[model samples]
Target chain A: MGKLKLAVGVAGALAVGVASLSALAAENIRIGLIEPLSGPIAAIGSEALDNFNHAADRVNARGGVLGGRKLEIIGLDNAMKAEKTTEQLKKAVDMGLSYVIQGVGSNHALNIIKFLDKHNKRNPGKEIVFLNHSAVTTAFTNELCSFWHFRFDANVDMKVAALVTQISRDPGVEKLYLLNQNYAYGKSFQAAANKLLKERATDVELVGDELIVPFGKVLDFTPYIAKIKASGADTVLTGNWGPDLHRFVKGAVDSGLGATFYTVYGGIPSSIGGYGDAGKKVNLKQVTEMHENQDGLPEDLRDYMKSYIEAYESTWYPDRYRWLIEQLAAAIDAAGTADPIPVAGKLEGMTFPGPLGEVKMRADDHQMQMPLVVSTLTSDVPKHLIYKGKDFGIGFKTDGVVERADTTLPTSCQMDRPG
Target chain B: MEVFAFSLFNGILYGMLLFMLASGLTLIFSMMGVLNFAHASFFMLGAYLAYQISAYVGFWPGLVVAPLIVGVIGAAVERWGLRPVHKFGHVAELLFTFGLAFVIEEVVQLIWGKVPMPYDIPASMNFAAFSWQGLDYSAYRLFMLVISVAIFAALFLFIAKTRIGLIIQAALTQPNIVSALGHDVPRIFMWTFGFGCALAGLAGVIGGNVLGTEPAMAITLGPIVFVVIVIGGLGSLWGALVAALFIGIVDNLAISYDLSFYPLFAVFGVERDVTGIMQDLVRLTTASIAPVLPYFLLVLILIVRPRGLFGTRDV
Candidate 1:
């Protein structure tokens, strides 16, 4: 009789445990962050993860999303390879995850879009939505637009337009030169620069244009700088990032070639390490979403940036991520279901508050329309910024903010909506 | 005319830097008969050590202290790691040094992480020393050129004039005879290997100041150093200098040219089309293929003269 009573009590306890476990699982929404978490670019992946986690925390702290259900971000390492990305996507699907976020490489982005298009068609009611945070290829939305994909960052054309606006305003930029990495993105950049300059700043003369291999190939850029100097180009525009950009700028400074450099990736504080004082006279300008050292930044946003810098020790993260999460939560709440199909429908043509005011996702192309800021790397900031245990004594100052309407570009995205 | 002069100037400066790195490899390969694959890693290690020491003390002390540390580590490797493997054969020594290179790079990455350290030119030497045709040559570069020449002269005098240098030269060819002279032949060999590594470390101290001091830098410079020694000939120190300068000038001139293969093909009456790989090759520019020009010169030399110019004998 004692054994029977003991067995019965144990079974009852086990039944209660099983019931709560199911309830707990149902109360959480898992979004897969498929990115390179282990490889050369792992630091970038983990930094993006931390930012996303903080965004989720902020959303959850605000009474949770979808009637108090928690948001869970599950990282799946792709090792920065395309094949591994496809495998991670399959794992996410098999695990019943409906949404995955990836943005480091456009190759991986294209892989996810093509994989999901077939997978969704083969198996109805199991659709996955791709939320892109930073892959900025213009053709992704314009030519290969997908109904299931939503991009939060501005594309190349919009960025070029913003830079050209600043160029037209500057009387010093009379002779323009274009130097870019010889690849698809670089070719697009050259095209965009030429097209936009013709349209916006026709007075600026293009004196020299050249393309070179990306990185690891060019050990010294002095020869190239000499050519630029010989061309008598007073202003130079380049789409080079990483070593290519920094080394060229360093060579220019060492050569004392006093031409202004308008670049794509010079705004990042970490990339321009040890180059602050040297780069001061070069008139380095970059186009981006926002800068910390604006003339009249709002107190709340300033406090927010201060807190983030205190946590991360560097300001290399893009601000569009926080905006991405806040907008996502709003879309989920409005849809009243965590299913990606209905949630994506709600996300299209959505508008929410951002650091720079109203941010929108255009229904035609699923591209986010937001205000872009053109900033110059300078020692003379309106406000001094200290970060990473060193008094930087330098910050990116706001040249001006291109309004959202001005940032919006026309798209050719024709989509097939679901029934 | 100005472009040509400027490019030539830049080429000579680059060639001298290459010689700074290639001289160490030449000593090891020619004197020791042991291909030290981890040579560039020693250079990398020297740069990293300098950066660390410079953070504590000033740059000047680190410049001395870092190379000493690197030399000590290299000597220990000769005593413990390479000496045992040396009896196995030349292939074993090659494989051992190759493995050592990988180990050093991994250890560097483990400690330093992936981001580049702020190892930059010292502010005291960061001014334009001269200007020609409105283009300034930096003081730091002048310092580099002086150091390279000084190193070349010192190495040349030490090997050609010093008593120990004579003994070393004798030991390489007459190891048994020198061993009979009541001297420690093994110890001399160990020190010679260490000295070769120290030269690389010294090169790293200056090279990292301008090029960069990262894990990938060793790999980037490793192949070019081998090119210098091979083209210089198997055992010629002077040959290394001449070959390095040749490659450097040719590389710079190649990069300065914007001319394409179009003109060459048009002269041959081969009209370019858009469809084929041959057509694309025809459209390729000289500046785009400048990185491969060194190897092209190497192959051309090997085909015409396998022994190499000024080299006493082939390896």
Candidate 2:
């Protein structure tokens, strides 16, 4: 009789211990970050991840979300491959992480959305939500849209619309040349530029529209530069990223091609070094969300930038990931649960204050509407703290900013929502 | 006419650089029946080492010291890495070098982040060397041309005239006989491999800034080096030279022109509502197809002459 009583007491104690451990686990929410942590573009992923972690720290410091439940980020290296990304997504699901963030490649984004849709259909109550901080392909929020996928960054059409507005304002750009990589993103960029140029800047002649090289294949761009010079193009508009952008700018400088490079990715690190002193002499412009030394930025953003630079030793770009997490936290709080379906529903058409100003996640499409800033690289240094170019060891000075009101383009998305 | 002249000049300069890289690989492959797949990786190492060294002691000293450092690394790789793999045969040796290439790239990324290093032309050489038809040619490119030509002449004399060169030549033909003559054949092999890598290092020292020294530099230039060797008649130095120049010039000329197939189709009087894959083919231009020219040439050459243009033996 005494032995039976002791056994009952031990069993009751074990049940209590398990229940308390689970409650402790429930106090924290895990968000998975799938990115290329290793490979050729690891630096890009590392910087983005650093920004994500910094954003998480800031959120947690501000008492987190859903009444102080701390947020934890789980990063998995997908190596920028689709197969590896799917595998990591599965792992994230198995770990009970309902929210996953991915950026970088649109191909990977499209694959993840398809994978998630299929997985959610099979698993019912275990549906996962995908938050895209970058990868601006239109199809993600357009024809290929999913109920579970939400993109925080502007799509290609929106960026093109903003870029065209900037280009039209400059009367010096009479002849424009379009050079881009031959891929989905590049094709979209070309198509949008063509349509937008015709609509907005009809006076500007399209001198050359060439998609001559594959991504990351062209080492020498002298031939291309020669063509541009021969065409007498006053402005060269390109959407090429990575080494392609750097090499093209370098070739232009080397060949003395006297054209303003109005590019989407001209401000990335090491690109300024490619221009050398030529950048100071040439017209180099880029479209971004935020830059250092903007006169009227909010105090909170300034403080955030200071802390981020102090920790990472690099300047932080206005990443949508920060705003996405804040918005996600607010949505979770509104829903009063960590379950993805309800939280995702709450996230639709959500409005939150971002670094630049107020940002809204469109209900029609899951695309975020935020401000775009058009800036130029000048010889002058910024008055405020800034991220210096790693290669050139010089800070980028901005010339202008286009507010969200002026840059946001109307979305053509007709989303098919999940009942 | 100006564009044609400029393209030709640029092509010749580019070809000479390719020759400098390929000459070493051809000699190494002939000497030790092992194709060093990591040859371009050593080239990349040379560039990165030069960049680091240049930060402390100016560019001129970096040029000298960096190649020597690469040579030592190459010799060590031969003694420790390649020598052991030789017993397992050529495939094992090739795979070993292939894996070494990846390891070197990862190490480069770890030491220097993935961004392109600020390996620019020295300030003194930044000005234009000359002007042709109102176009300014960079002084540094001219300097690169002179260095490549000088190295070629020096390498030619060293291999054709020196006593060590004669021994190396003999060993290429009869390794066992040369070893029997009180010569340490393995040490000679190690020295030859190191010398070959040093040549590649020299190419990198010059080519790095022009080509942009990043982690992907090895993979970018690796295949072209192999193509040069194969087309030049794998074991022959002169053959490699001719092939490299040919490829470089042809590639440049192809890129310089933008001839569309649509015009060709019109000339042939085959004008119909082109659709599907046919339409895509019709829209193709010379500039779009230029990157593949060298590979196309390689295939054609292989089919026509399996031994290559100047090859004395089968590759």
Candidate 3:
């Protein structure tokens, strides 16, 4: 009788342990962040990761999706290479991570989308959904759009459209020079700029259109600056990012090229610190989703920025990833399962209150329609600047904000849905 | 005329900087019979060290001290890293340096966090040297020209006139004979390697501000330095100088001009609607081809004159 009682007690304890372990497993959803964690743009990747984690923490605090299942983010470094990104994606899948987020390079995103589509086809139940936070390539949503890939940030056309609207209004910009990196994204930027300029600002002359340097290769832009000055361009438009952007701005300042720079990525953190005082001199206009101290910003966003800046001593662009995650969580809850296919199905046409404003994930192409802000860099820090952690006396001053209604662009994507 | 003058000046300045880097690499390659692939990494290290040193000391002191620190590190690397692998032959030495380059980049990223340092021109030298045709020539660039020229003159005189230089020259030609003598040949090799690295470091100190001091700076300038030495002549210092300047000037001129392949095709009466590769070929401009010009020159020189312009021996 004593032996039987001891066996029964042990069995009960084992059963309880198994039950708790299963419960713990059910209470967490894992997401993988595959990005360039160690390269020229590692800083950008790190900042984005920090913001995502901060958003995850907030969600978990408010009782995570699907009846308090905590959101977990696992970061994997892609090293800014497509091959490495594919390897990371495979690794993430092997680790049972169904949801993956990547940005930085459009080529990487396109390749990963192809990889995921192939993988999903092979393994039907185990599908990985990619949430692209930053890569603004139009081809990702148009010609190469995958059911597996959903982009939260505005595409090149949308951002360029908003920029064109602002440029058309500005009487100062007469002669414009277009300088871009030689790549798919850069080519798209150039095409969009040409199309937008024809429609919006016909008076402005296209002085020079040059595809100057390969991405992450150029060390000096003085020669390029000399060409821009010689072109007699009053304004310059470029989609160059990372060191290319920083170096170009510095070269312009050093050479005393008085042309105003209108860029898609002028407000990167490295540019602010790298350009120093020269950054303040150039009329650097950037089309972004968010900037500190913009009027009519929601209080919740202000609080989120405050907490994020205080926790992580860096600034993040297009905090749309946070909203993307929120919608992802809602979709999971709505689907009643953590399966990627179901979650992806539920995410289509999902509307969520984003930091900028209300954002909708269009079912047709999986592109998020959200507000875009065009701002200029100034040395003046406003009193309402909630995200100022340690400003080098450079901050973005809001010029104009294009609403989500104005940011919608036609997509040629015919997404093949899973049965 | 102003554009021509400006491009020429900028090219010469860029060439002088290249020469500073290539001179050391040429010296090491000629003496050690080992291509120091990590030579540009040492240049990158110099910039980072200068940035760190400049934070504590002024830029002047940083400029003086950083190269010295780099020289010491180079000597240590020669004594420890390269000397052990030297017996494995040229391939081994090359592989070691190549591996060292990757290691150095990783270590640099760990320390510097992958973002460029605020290594700008000194405030005193920030003003324009002159203005012509509504363009202001940077005073800092002219300062670089003066410094590099001084270094070249000093190096030329030291190598030509000094007894130690004569010993180094003799050792380069007949290492076994020099080793048989009372003088320590390996010690000379070590010192020469250190000195070569120091020259690269000095180049880095000046080039960092202009090029932007980041981890990728080494990779950006490394291959170009090799091109300079190869095109000029592998072992000839004068050859390296001439090749660097020539390449630099041609590169700048090519970039400054916007001549397209479309015009050439039009001249040949090829008015057909082009698509695919042909369309891309037609759209190609001199500016687009500028970056590849050095490599093009390298290939052409190799095919035509394998010994290079002034090379006494084939590399």
Q: What is the TM-score of chain A in candidate 2?
A: 0.91
The candidates, ranked best first by TM-score, are 3, 2, 1
Going through the candidates in the order shown, the clash numbers are 0, 1, 0
TM-score of each: 0.89, 0.93, 0.94
C-alpha RMSD by candidate, in order: 3.8, 2.9, 3.0
- Categorize the docking of model 1: acceptable
Summarize candidate 1's per-residue lDDT along B51-151 as a digit string, tens digits.
77877886788878888888888889989999999889889999999999988877886787655566777778888999876678888899989988988
Candidate 3: TM-score? 0.94
The number of residue pairs in model 3 that clash at the backbone is 0
Write the number of the candidate with greater TM-score, choosing between 2 and 3.
3
For candidate 2, write residues B140-210 as lDDT tens digits.
Answer: 87888788788767777878889888888888779889999988888998999998888788888888877
Model 2, span A22-83: residue lDDT tens? 78655789999999999867777777788888898998998887667888888889988889
In Å, residue A408's CA in model 1 sits off its true spot by 2.6
Where in model 3 is the C-alpha error above 4 Å?
Answer: A1-25, A383-390, B263-273
The worst-scoring run of ten residues by lDDT in candidate 2 chain A lies at: A384-393
Best to worst by DockQ, what's the order? Answer: 3, 2, 1
Docking class of 3: medium
Ranking by lDDT: 3, 1, 2
